[model samples]
Target: MAYLFLFGAIVAEVIGAISTRFSEGFTRVLPTVVAVVGVVGAYFLLSRALRAGMGIGVAYAIWAALGVCAVALVGVLFLGESLTGVQAAGVALVIGGVACLELGGQH
Candidate 1:
């Protein structure tokens, strides 16, 4: 299903992004490779999902928004990155907008 693929893409992207913390600015070879491979695989799955019938604008919006949210949480928890209230609000807005686009596209 398109939704499944979209979720897969989100997961892969999140993994890749969080892995960057371990990659140590690309000085670590294995982690760097994992990040690159994970991200590429995510995109590949995303493209396949799009071809399966999802609209480009909707699919991309969902991917981008979800990726941002997931990556931000990982950064906050694992990487000790701080987010302001404004940044959190912005991410919530992005998620809401993505949901709206998906629902609208269904009709």
Candidate 2:
């Protein structure tokens, strides 16, 4: 389904971004390889999702917003990165915007 494909794209992008942090500026071979592969797969799935009838604006917005949220969470939890109140508020706003976009567009 188109939704599934879009979800896959978001997941892949989040994973790729998280792996990139582990790649140590691409000095680490394995994580770097994973990041590259994950990025390629993310784009592939995103293209498929677009082909499956989702509007480009909605698909891209959803993918980018969710990917950012996921990556931020991963950074805080797995990578021990600090998240300040301002960043948390920004993330909440992105989530709210995504929800509003979906709700307003749904017929």
Candidate 3:
């Protein structure tokens, strides 16, 4: 269930990021609200995951990695953002780093 909570945090962060794009610099109402609420929820669940025995470094790395990847995809698919080769490589490197972090500390 620690993993579950981490997943929830990741999802909430992704949704919050996407909603932030739609928020138009906080000039909009609905998306802005979603962004704020979603982010708060993300932090809450992330704390729970940590309490459930997830290492802070590992959990934060995973949360940031997944949330960023998801947000980039959402931007490409829905927000018409550019995803160049450079961005792709950057994402790959981030995932690779996550792998290293996960594996390097394994007993």
Candidate 4:
């Protein structure tokens, strides 16, 4: 299903983004490889999902917004990155907007 492909794309993007934290500005070897692979794989899956008939606007919005939220959480949880209250609220708004984009299609 297209949604499945889109989900893969989302997961890949999240991994890629988190790996960026590990990559050390691409100076490290292994983490950098993972980052490159994950990011490229994400785009590959996204393209496939689009070709399979997912609407461009809705799918892209969901992918990008959710990816941002996931990456931020990982940064705070595992990468010692600070997440201010305002930043948390911003992530919430991103998710809310994605939800609107998805649910708005029903009406």
Best by TM-score: 3
**Where does candidate 2 clash, by residue pair?**
none
> Which whole-number lDDT from 0 to 100 does residue 98 have in model 1?
94
Ranking by lDDT: 3, 2, 4, 1
Off by over 4 Å in 1: none
The lDDT per prediction is: 0.89, 0.92, 0.94, 0.90
Give the worst 10-residue stretch by lDDT in candidate 4.
Answer: 15-24
Query: What tens-digit string does per-residue lDDT give for candidate 2 at 1-107?
Result: 88999999998998789889889999999999889988999999999999999888889999999999999998899888999999999999999999999898988
**Model 4 lDDT vs. the true structure?**
0.90
Q: Write the per-residue lDDT of candidate 3 for residues 12-56, one digit (tens) a residue.
A: 999898889889999999999999999999999999999999999
Q: Write the per-residue lDDT of candidate 1 for residues 25-85, one digit (tens) a residue.
A: 9999998998998799889989988988888899899999999998998889877899999
The total number of steric clashes, by the backbone 3 Å criterion, in model 4 comes to 0
Q: What is the TM-score of each candidate against the true structure?
A: 0.91, 0.94, 0.96, 0.92
lDDT of 4 by residue, 9-46 (tens): 99999988888887899999888988899999999999
TM-score, predicted candidate 4 vs. hidden true structure = 0.92
Off by over 4 Å in 2: none
